[model samples]
Target: MKRPSLVLCCALLGIVPTACGPGSDPDPGVDRGDSSTVDLEHLAITVSGRAAVFPEAARLLEAQGQPVPSLDGVVLTVEEPLRVGVSDADSVLGQGGIGADGGFSVSEVPVRDIHLSLAASLQQEGFVRSSTIIFDTAFTRTRPHTDIIDARAWALPNAFHDALTRSIGDASIRAHSGERASTLRDAGFILGRVVDAAGAPVAGARVVLDRDDLAGRVYYPAPDFQSATQDGTSATGLFVYVHSGTAAETFSLSIEGTQAYLPRNAGATPGLGLVLTLYPGNVSP
Candidate 1:
């Protein structure tokens, strides 16, 4: 699939991608220090939450009216910086996978006023190795840590909620101290599918979303176009784009290939789903 430039991709998503380079801190190894001698003022944080299955997989399950697959193999990582007199050091607080019951625990996390980063990863066949990150989670001992997952409130398609809830049960997770709860009101996403003239799934097509107002452009199989080899086309021909913008915005969807699809101009909304049928003729973007 042909890819667009990074600047164009970030603009479409309306996000400034975080830069990682040689000067950046390395992964914080898991902390396993004894808790007995820890300062009495610090509290151990316990984080539990559910993982959403892959988007295409969720859609397939929904179409079949089957139960969403379990996230038993999904892994969750929690990290916070170790602060010195002035500098902060890299340190991983805890990491674990979701249990069969859909719950996960990261015990004995040291209490600190730090920027917490939580990430969840799911690896399974027929689905891309997917991972989502929530950064800058403000954590404190005074705040309830039981609902850590709820606090992150990563925007996900509504169709995936059933499986997520079944895996993690109860969506009322807590946020770290001084953090605001994530609500659907602050969410935005785009769902779409590509098919050939015969209505069969089309894989390896480059999908792009260009903002109507020239605000930015978003490219599918993101991070870079070359990564598309690994992130390209799901088994179901479905593509999902989740962003931090409001649903009120508008965008024009484009497919980079010899053929063109219908309904090029689309509304960017929380649950908007677009079905594009490829034709034989090429259309200019």
Candidate 2:
């Protein structure tokens, strides 16, 4: 009896409820159509030899993470300067700085084939150590990095190669004020930083370890290629390892955070350690 009156009253009021009703399709919110970029930057590059080994002449970048050495006047060809153009060949990103360590760096470069034309100065000391480099700007998540022999039928018994194989860097081998005979031992080095796509340090990233830089070198310190941290680690800036001798100095490091190279002169000990942080928008850490 009361049901009839209640039903009529509810129907008249038009009350609608869904506390126990079937769910419907989710609401499609208004999407502002705009393009967003991941903001990836070119992989940083570094070297540990005389200048003019990279971007000067036509030399192939052995690995994707290899640094382009600074060889400005060193010119690839006596006729043309070492042009640092993108793989697209439209605009030329500015030249990277050549530090005292004879290394060059481009903080923000597109991930593309960096061509160094040095046909004119091929025979030069450090112009074309290997060959022209073909690289990709993609972040290194899968394969780490490897050095290519870059040997051609052109030069045999390369003096530099011989010196490196014999562990005779800085042939003159001067002794600094605080340097010692142990300094001549050639303790291998490890250098790197943790960075992001926007050239920023990303801390809290587990750092990993690898020795790809030392593979195939005739000698342990065969010129360039250091090892380092590779476990999930939040970088804390330049980490240096202090070990006893050159015998145990093989550190090829890669970081989930931004990468940075520790200059040779910058370190006083044999094994070097480093940790770098990454911030949003690739800001420097």
Candidate 3:
């Protein structure tokens, strides 16, 4: 079979393209009952990573005097992108549990030139889940990979139930915090990256929702939250938007400015974990 162009694969990760080369199908280094796609030579890969609530969320919780959730029972998984409507059961490349220090090291993962995504979730209630595209070159068995996985909260943690009893006088902190936390739970979370045709990160790009109705409902999390209105994505070409509106909402994204890339209108649902890798002038795949 003909392989995807290097530009395409690199574009998906927002990495600079090295050159085009022959490779097998973009099958994840997973055993999905398709023995033909499994390359045993690449199975010794080791991926170590840390899982913690994002700084913004952590600060917010700390300010509220709530402790960060324990890392016990947290699970990390290495996975490959699957087609829409496809079951993920067959796409798991590897999985590991987080330690007390919120660290994880998963070995024996299948890695090649294959595109992969790392996902971390807490089995505990009210903790936000996280999934990010590797956003770099393909993982290779020649070396170990280290990653930091930042998680956040989407629901009103049971620990914060005190907010429900506070009077309307504390709306700014109590209500606002509750609103931000619940917004991520009810609506969804979106993480995006913009890249040029050659796959380098585009620094000044701004991602926007096409819906006029969602004007105030969209919010940027802390640290870089304020930057969303000023400088847009940084050199990393990363931006995050979460819904603070009522009900689950579905929408597509459009980038402002005169870039050659078209907006992705594939009905992205944030609750399902959307990590977008945008390429200029090419949105087909």
- RMSD each, Å: 19.5, 23.3, 11.1
2 or 3, which is superior by TM-score? 3
Q: Where is model 1 more than 4 Å wrong at Cα?
A: 1-44, 54-57, 61-68, 79-92, 110-116, 123-127, 133-215, 219-285
User: For this target, which candidate reaches the highest lDDT against the unseen true structure?
Assistant: 3
Candidate 2 Cα misplacement greater than 4 A, ranges: 1-71, 74-185, 204-206, 210-237, 241-285
Q: What TM-score, computed on C-alpha atoms, does each candidate reach?
A: 0.32, 0.22, 0.47
| 163-209: candidate 3 lDDT, tens digit per residue | 22121122222243345444333334455567776667777677766
Best by TM-score: 3
Worst 10 residues of 2 by lDDT: 148-157
Q: How do the residues 45-78 of candidate 2 rate in per-residue lDDT, one tens digit apiece?
A: 2111223442211122434343544344332211
Candidates 1 and 3 compared: the better one by lDDT is 3
Which window of ten consecutive residues has the lowest lDDT sum in model 3? Answer: 161-170
Cand. 1 TM to true fold:
0.32
TM-score ranking of the models: 3, 1, 2
- Runs with alpha carbons beyond 4 Å of true place in candidate 3: 1-40, 81-85, 112-123, 135-183, 192-205, 208-239, 242-270, 274-285
Candidate 1 worst ten-residue window by lDDT: 169-178
